[model samples]
Target: MVFKDKGRVMDGFYVTGHPSVPVYVLKSGVIFDGGFTALARHYERDIRDILGNTSPEYIFITHSHFDHVGSISYFKSVWPDIKVFGSVNAKKILSRNGAIELIQRLNNISRAHLLSYGVNDLYEGEFEPFLPDEVVEDGSVIRVKDGLEIHSRYTPGHTRDFMSYWIPEKRILIASEAAGCDDGSGYIISEFLVDYDEYINGIKRFMEMDVEVLCVGHRYVITGDDVRSYLLSSLQHAKDFVEMVINILNEENGDIDKTVNRVKAYEWDPRPFPKQPEMAYLLNTQARVKLIASKYMKN
Candidate 1:
């Protein structure tokens, strides 16, 4: 199922995490049309619609999620000069997997785990992939024209390689998926089951920024006076959610299924559901499970 078109492209969508930042209609195209309903290349059309014949100079990805990177190759095909930047680790992942294989994996997995919330059909078939020409490591500054620098801070915990971009000049902070989400409603923030600690710290890091505008991945941009408060509330909720799950696991004597179910039972903000769970949760779960298994193996 696809997210209903709230309005035409450019209709103001409210971002949740930070209330002070206003989002422009930079792009309204969906790489994954109707949440993976079609196998065709819809993103090309989406970009054309939003850009209206103007090619974008920079495309910044939050991570290596299939949907986020879906149209990357197409963008490269159209504009040879366009530069695509993403977390350094994501670039490594792309380098190992040929673009055709990557797209094929996403296409095939499009509808595999519907029982899992936010599961959509992955892309199938072979498509060209655009390997990043440059990797932006954590703390690296991405300077756009005229001294607008987007600082790439490594905020591990989402994924080992996830980085959040900070603009000190405009005081605009683009958390990618780091700042949680706004969900275009009143205020909706995302909670991940990944490294709850890194997730928490990631949110707190934004508080230190003199950020007045916040743009998060997968939701409408948010801007307002209550940005900081709302973001903190979201962070606390994630902490509590993870802590409760850990506590329940301890009580159950390490019942993995129960732990998973308890974590799942926590109320997920509906708005972010369709676009999640983020890649961080997938990676974090694997990492934590490995850590748990290692302990038992050693014992």
Candidate 2:
């Protein structure tokens, strides 16, 4: 069943949350970053039904993280002819046998957690290695259809391989983890797993763009005034976190655990997820503290 191409609408088609699948759909097909086939297991059919007869032409990965590229195998199985695009670093990471195995192993960890929550319609095909057809870098224009073009920009800092996309004419910017992950409501989690400077710089880079529609990496979109609101919050949060981590480290004499704990209590704008478990918050807090320490508090 093939879906007919429709005219470009202001908001073509966007979906998010529940199972946490975020994709930016265009007229040609749909564009997405990370995917968890296991999470989307129960909703894949509904997702397909929503898109009707439209087929994917490409799946542009934002980074090489296990969660980001987890469903490549499943997507490949569904759309064999779809081209995969990502940064050169992402290409190298996906090309490795070791990395592929590690991704599958991590995916299993995610799947087991999903089942605990009662989601079990997942396909058992993620333990396979899948490579991209196109290796793009900063400033690469990928033509999805006759007139639609997605310009790739290498926005490292989320991981060295992180890439974001910009559709010039539409004023839409698909910022990868370079910005921050929005937890549905309004809370944003600033996870700079690498360097704090890089993460902040990446956000600043996108801030220069005239974005009307902002697509975040996690599972949310910001439009109108919220687009600016999210970016401003992202910038301020990163700065605040870095400063707090540094001050805590200085006072605690570089005690990472103490710093992480302090950061854990820091209030996010609006608030963190209402149902966020302590363990999850602790883990992300630890990551934020560690990265901040490595980038700022180092001796």
Candidate 3:
């Protein structure tokens, strides 16, 4: 799908062949969120068709999660000199040998699942090594073209490395997972793997922007008058989830599994793709449960 604001043009493609992997391309040839390598390799031709020209000057990564950046190598294979941008923490995560191995493992799992769904055009190469060519901090403006500037907003809850992008001219905010995954049904599947507090704060920061178009990291994109509501509702979801987790733990007498199941009843909305895998979601829920417990239940 494509949208135009002012004179700037933006188009979205499932670069990774999964609804969860959104790669937004600007007319200036800047790509947002490269997605996983295996899926990206599978859909490289389709992605190239969308861009018309496969080469991009820069690819901005929102976070260093395996899903978000597993395909960094794909672009390098196409345009070896394309500059990659990400948060400092993301730079560190992608630099480690163990992290690369873990990312590759995650890539394989996603590939198999996608193939079962009949997406058979995936490429034959293995995921390649990557280290961000540039580490971006909050308040950085990357001038990819003469009149277009990409602004970075550091949102470090989805991961300490998350950084969402804003384009002032288009009033577009590529909110990434920081605004939570938009379930294609007006709901944000809030993810707070590291810290609930930071997640909430990040949502609030997005709310402050004059965002006319909110491009998520996944299935749906928000535009028109609905952008504000999306951000507000996403904030509420996070607050509600954290409160529910804390309350459930207290009521269950600190039984983590029970609390997870109870909270699952509320958080799990079978909307569509872009939702985390069940195993991944449960693991994240467990981490969130334990984090909140240590902070509040430890009296």
Candidate 4:
């Protein structure tokens, strides 16, 4: 399921993918990817050439993670006149907080990212991180073209400000990392959980929608009425997760890490969960804890 052409349907609806990079272009010339890289030794020209080479009128970011946003600078350079859109929180993070610490941490472990791009992949030259030019919050509608409307819906279980896109006209929903990834197998791999219930609710929102196409961040996309049915099934899995975590916390007196692994065992595919067990636990624990914490905090 490699996305080779400029525009092609994965399940249904136009999309494109990069070999090491993740690039998706819509039928309306809306090009979207998460990041930009300047290292040509790796592949592709500087961020400048990648954006300049394409005719994408608009750019939408799924989240502000390093991989997802590596080519943002390229788009901004070529389409200085075009608008770059991302979650409002992502915009604020780029503008207000300098994520230097986070970048360094990611680089330390991102050997694969470097190897994929090829050669001295670490930021060596006068490299600068790509920042969003504009912000689009939850429920914001992106008019890709006439009759093609992509709606930005907030689903913060992955990251606090993460969002997924929906197109009502086509009944297609891009879940980003919200609904998690279903390998050809029976289990699901989650990106990270900032809020388990909200993530489940987000999945439910899309499942309830009149969607026929469901494109996620990675892996194969699912379509037809079966999309909603699968989503509902995923939601049940998540709910069972919440219940399992609750039971574990009660037994171990809030052992977050222990509870996280207990849940991870339920995953069908584990490669996407990352190697370091602690890192995996850290990513998944916060999501469940936050979901429970919010329940108590609500008035």
Candidate 5:
């Protein structure tokens, strides 16, 4: 089953924020990702209402992307003692001035975009930069409480700092972008921006896990038999998408710009509302095309 609404996925897991940029909160006081600042602000009341007296203790960052970490500073302001966790590379990325500025800019764009779509109840707070309280390497286990333990798995490629959290006892995997995103269009958009091979490997690793519930980075929370089905299909889609990009690059005479434009027109341009912003989409598509070109194109 795929859940696209903002509500409780089960007893303790709740999905808040716009479907375009959803945030996951666990009753164990752990958040999967921060999501966009504006959307986070819009859903603050809902998230707080869901949490009630359970103050969030930790935030597990999947990556250092603008959308992913946009609300960390806001979250910190709410829960001053909440410790943020991310990969070592994410810590570095979030600390850089240029990256922070870019994140703020993208967040503003998202804010305007949401307002244009009639979502005007967003809080007026700005995006703030923050560093992770602790960096978790691959295989690191975070003991959230007596029965819940979150195992961090380093799953890169969408970004070098990407990390996915796994809860063995609950059979849940908070795989933000590591398993790609299902835009509810019956397609898994392959987001291997940094390294295609690493992305593919990450999906394969996820396929080997015992997951009953799969929470992706955006749009959908999959459960039951669909978890493995989604993993298998995501792996296949990544492979096929990379191969398609390679073919396009070759046909375009190994021109990265042309290939990116071509792929964007074909895959991204026709997407409906609540899709990725144009600038972010073009940037990520360029990176993916460049990676494919560098790896597969003949000299």
Candidate 6:
């Protein structure tokens, strides 16, 4: 079952903001991702209502992408004591001025896109870049409470800093982009921005886990038998996407630019609204194509 509603989907899990860039919150006062600034502000009341009196104490960042961390500053302003956690590489990325600027720019573009879609309650502000308070390496376990523990897995590929959190007690895995995204189109989008091999390995690792609830990065919260089904399909999709890219690269005689354009025209241009921004899409596509061309086309 796919959940896209903006409320409590299960006992302790809540989804807020736009489904395209939804934020996940636990009743125990932990937020999975920051989401967009405007959307976060618009859904602030809903988030607070779900949290009740328990002020959010921690935010676990999946990666350092613009949309994934768009509302960190807003959350910090609301809960000044909230500590943010991410991988060590994420800390390095967020500290760079160029990265922050690009994030802000992409956020501005995203807000405008939202407005065009008739979303009028977006928060007005530039994206703020804040470093994580703690860096979690692979296999680090955070005790959320006496009985609840959030285990961090360093699953890179969507980004080198990507991390997936799993709660064994609840049988929930916050896979983020590590397990691909639904995008409301019933199609899983493989997001291997940095390394395709690592992305596939990350998916394989998730497949080995016993998951009941799977929280993707965007637009879908899968549950029950679908969890294993989704992970298996996601793994296949990631491999198929790479194969398609390699075929296109070969067709283009290993020309990265041409392959990127062809892939964009075939895969991205047909996607409807509530999708990734064109600039972001192009950048990620270029990275994927370049990686494939260099890694697979090396005679």
lDDT of 5 at 175: 90
Cα shift from native, residue 219, model 6 (Å): 0.6
Q: Report how far residue 93 has shifted in candidate 4, in Å.
A: 1.7
- TM-scores, one per candidate: 0.68, 0.82, 0.88, 0.73, 0.97, 0.97
Query: What is the Cα-based lDDT of residue 79 in candidate 1?
Result: 62
**Residue-level error in angstroms, candidate 5, position 173:** 0.4
**Candidate 6 global lDDT:** 0.86
Provide backbone clash counts, one per model: 21, 2, 2, 13, 0, 1
Error of 4 at 209 (Å): 1.7
Candidate 2 structure lDDT: 0.69
Decide which is better by TM-score, 3 or 6: 6
- Candidate 2 global Cα RMSD: 5.1
- For all predictions, the C-alpha RMSD in Å is 6.8, 5.1, 3.5, 5.0, 1.2, 1.2
Model 1 segments more than 4 A misplaced: 1-43, 98-128, 182-194, 267-299
Q: 187 in model 4: Cα distance from truth in Å?
A: 1.2
Q: What tens-digit string does per-residue lDDT give for candidate 2 at 1-299?
A: 11112222255545432324444456456556646656544334544655676667778888887767776666677767778888888889888888887678777766766666676576665656777788888999987764778889877776778888898877878885788876654556776776677788888888888888776755556666777778888888777767777888999999999777666666532353332335545655777778777767659
For residues 58-158, what per-residue lDDT tens digits would candidate 1 score against the true structure? 76666655545555665566766777777668777667656446544653454343335442342343445556667788788866654466677877655
Which candidate leads the pack in lDDT? 5
- Model 4 Cα lDDT, one tens digit per residue, 1-299: 32323344542345433333446555565655543243322323332234446556777887776556654664455457656788877876655444634543453455444545453644443224656666788878767665688788888878776878877877767676787765445455544456666777788788668877676665556667567666776777666656666776667566666655665665423544223233434555566555653553343
Give lDDT: candidate 6, residue 77.
85
Tens digit per residue, CA lDDT, model 6, 214-236: 88888888888888888888888
Q: After superposition, how far is residue 128 of candidate 2 from its true place, in Å?
A: 2.2
Across 130-198, the per-residue lDDT of candidate 5 in tens digits comes to 999999999999999547999999988799999999989888899989898986787889989998889
Clashing pairs in 5: none
